[model samples]
Target: MLKGKKIVITGASSGLGLMTAMKLVQQGARVAITGRNESKLQAAVQSVPHAGRLSTYVLDVTDAEAAAKTLDRIWREMDGVDVLVNNAGFGYFERFIDAPLEHFEQMMDTNYMGVVRCTKAVLPQMLRRGSGQIVNIASIAGKLGTPKSTGYSASKHALLGFTNALRQEMRGTGIIVSAVNPGPFESPFFQTADPGGTYVSSVQSLMMKPERVADAVVKAIVKRKAEIDLPGWAALGVKLYHLFPRLSDRIAGGMLNKK
Candidate 1:
């Protein structure tokens, strides 16, 4: 479904972004990947099968002006951008009181504002073209909050809201906006969490693989789905929580206490 389409992915150095890039390439998409680490980006391109169709850009999504400049360059080189996957984000799993203010700021800047910056940079062109797809890699935390993940949850929640609003506003524009909220994925996310924060030790076995999430992204883009949550059971659980907040909070509190 992505044949000959120009797609740009952020945080493409490793993990979910890298996996998604490979998947998209295999499906015949021309990919432009961005990361702060040049060596990692080079290595990622080498690892993909159609390395010729993959281009790398060293960019920090937190820098709004720099992100816009980089996007402009990419659009010029790629001819036009057909899809944008906003997957650049990090997490700090610590209690609200224990987490530093800087950590919260970093999470908001990268996870939430990063998406905003990239979307704004590309929206004018997409709107003019009247065809584009935006896939946001949010998390289950965005749907149901957990202890010691206040900032991460908040950032994702913001992304979710933005995606919803964008989708509504672009209803008849032929521009697609969707979000994927996946359960614990077996990516580097946990290991990359702030060193000072307390990480979730339990439910490790329940984590899905990064490839699963990447596959879901491709499906969402192809189908132009409004939103998706991986592992049908996980999606059901999140919905149930939304329906019964008091019960959900009690269960979540218990899980945290047990940990």
Candidate 2:
């Protein structure tokens, strides 16, 4: 479905971003990837089969102005972006009190504001063309908070809210806004979390692979779905938690207490 399309993905150095880039390229999409690590980005490009169809930009999404400029330059070179995957984000598994203010600020900046910056940079072009799609890689934590993930969860929740508001504002415009909330994915995300984070190693055992999450992202883009939550059980859990707050709290409390 993505054949001949130009797609840009952030955080494409590794993990789900890299996986999605590979998949999209395999399906005949010209992919542009951005990452803070230049070497890693180059390595990722080489690892893909049709490396010729890919371009890499070294960017830190937290820097709004830089990201905007880079996006403009990329669009000029690529002729315009047909799909945008805002996949750049970080996670921290620490209690609210123990987590430094800077950590929270960084989380908000990269996870929430990064989306805002990238979306704003691309929106004018998309609106001008009257056709585009944005796929935000949010998390299940965006829907329901879990222990030791206060800042990460808050940032994701804010992102989901922003996506919803933008979707409403873009109504009648040909642009499509969608978010994908995946359950824990087996990636470097957890290992990259705050060093003093609280999540145990066993927790990582249940995570799905990056390829699994990438497939869901491709589906969302192809179908233009409004929102998606992976692992049906996780989606159901979010709804159930909302409906039974007290019980949910107790259950969550028990889970945390075990740690």
Candidate 3:
């Protein structure tokens, strides 16, 4: 279904973004990938066998001006973007009291405001065309708070709020806004999010593969699903938490503090 479609994905240097770009390109989509590191962006383009189907841009989504300019270039180069995947974000897991104030600011800027800047830049074109799809890479952490993820969870929560509201506001406008909420995955995310390596070891068995999450992203885009939660068991846990908040905290409180 992605054949010949023009797509843009942020943070495509590695992990979920890169994997999803590969999947889309394999399905014959023309994808433009952006990342903060130029070397990594070029490397990602080289890693793909279908280089012709990919374009690379160096973008730090935190900079609103740079995001606007880079997206304008993408529109010019790709003719127009049919889909946009906001996948650029990082997590730093630290206790709320011990964490530095800057950590929270950085998370909010990249995980929440970054999406805002990119969406603002692209929405005009999508509106002009009257059809588009926006996929926001969120997390189950947003749904249920966990210890040591105060800032990260808050940022993702804000993102989910924006995504949900935007989907409603865009109703009947021919634009699809969807959110992908994945649980912990095996990726470099933990290298920074858990620099001490404690959390990864604690949840090694539960870490889903990046490829699996990427596959779900592709499916969400193709199916235009409103939302996707990875690893069915984890998703069910989130559902149960909503259904029985007090009971959930009592039953699973200890497990949520692996970090």
Candidate 4:
């Protein structure tokens, strides 16, 4: 179903975004990937099985002006974007007190405002065509705010809120707005989020494979699923947290403090 469809993904230099782009290319979709590093984007292009079907753009989603121009260029270059994946973001894990306020500001800028800017750039064309899909790469942290993820969680929470509302607005418009909320996966994201490897070690047993999560992302796109939470077991915790907030927090306190 994805054959010949034009898709754009941000942060495709590495991790889940890169994997998803490659997977889509493999499925015969034309993909345009963007990243802050030009060299890394070039490297990602080389890694794709069908290089001709993949294009790269150097972009920093945090820059609203540049993002608008770059996304517009991509839309024209690719003929049009049938799907857009808002996957550009990073996380840093430090206590609210120890972490500088600047860290949170950066996170909010890149994770929340970035999505807004890119979505705005594409929504007009999508509305004109009456069909499109916007997939926001949120996190499990968005649903259940854990220790040491205050900024990251807040940004993702905002993304989730925006996605939910956008999905409501897009109903009956042949446009799909979805959020992929995944648990900690084996990706370079932890390099910054858990430099000491403490949290990764603590969640070693629960760490998911990027390949599996990439498959789930493609499935969500094809199925037009509203939301996806990786590792069914972890999603159970989110449900429990919603049902019993105080009790869930108390019971999960130790586990949540791995960082």
Best by TM-score: 3
In the range 140-232, model 3's lDDT, one tens digit per residue, is 999989999999999999999999999999999999999999999998888899989999999999989899999999989999999999889
User: Model 2: per-residue lDDT, tens digit, 163-191?
Assistant: 99999988999999999999877777867
Model 1 Cα displacement at 170 (Å)? 0.7
lDDT of 4 by residue, 1-259 (tens): 9999899999989999999998999999999999999999998888889889999999999898998999999999888999999999999999998999999999999999999999999999999999999999999999999889999999999999999999999999989999999998999999988999999999999899999899988988889889999889889999999999999888888878888
Clashes of 2: 0
For model 3, what is the error of residue 174's alpha carbon versus the real structure, in angstroms, after optimal superposition?
0.3
> Clashing pairs in model 4?
none
The parts of candidate 4 lying over 4 Å away from their true place are none
lDDT of 3 at 108: 98
Ranking by lDDT: 3, 4, 2, 1
Q: State TM-scores per candidate.
A: 0.95, 0.96, 0.99, 0.98
Against the unseen true structure, what C-alpha lDDT does each candidate score?
A: 0.89, 0.89, 0.95, 0.93
Model 2 TM-score? 0.96
Q: What is the lDDT of residue 59 in candidate 3?
A: 95
Per model, how many backbone clashes are there? 0, 0, 0, 0
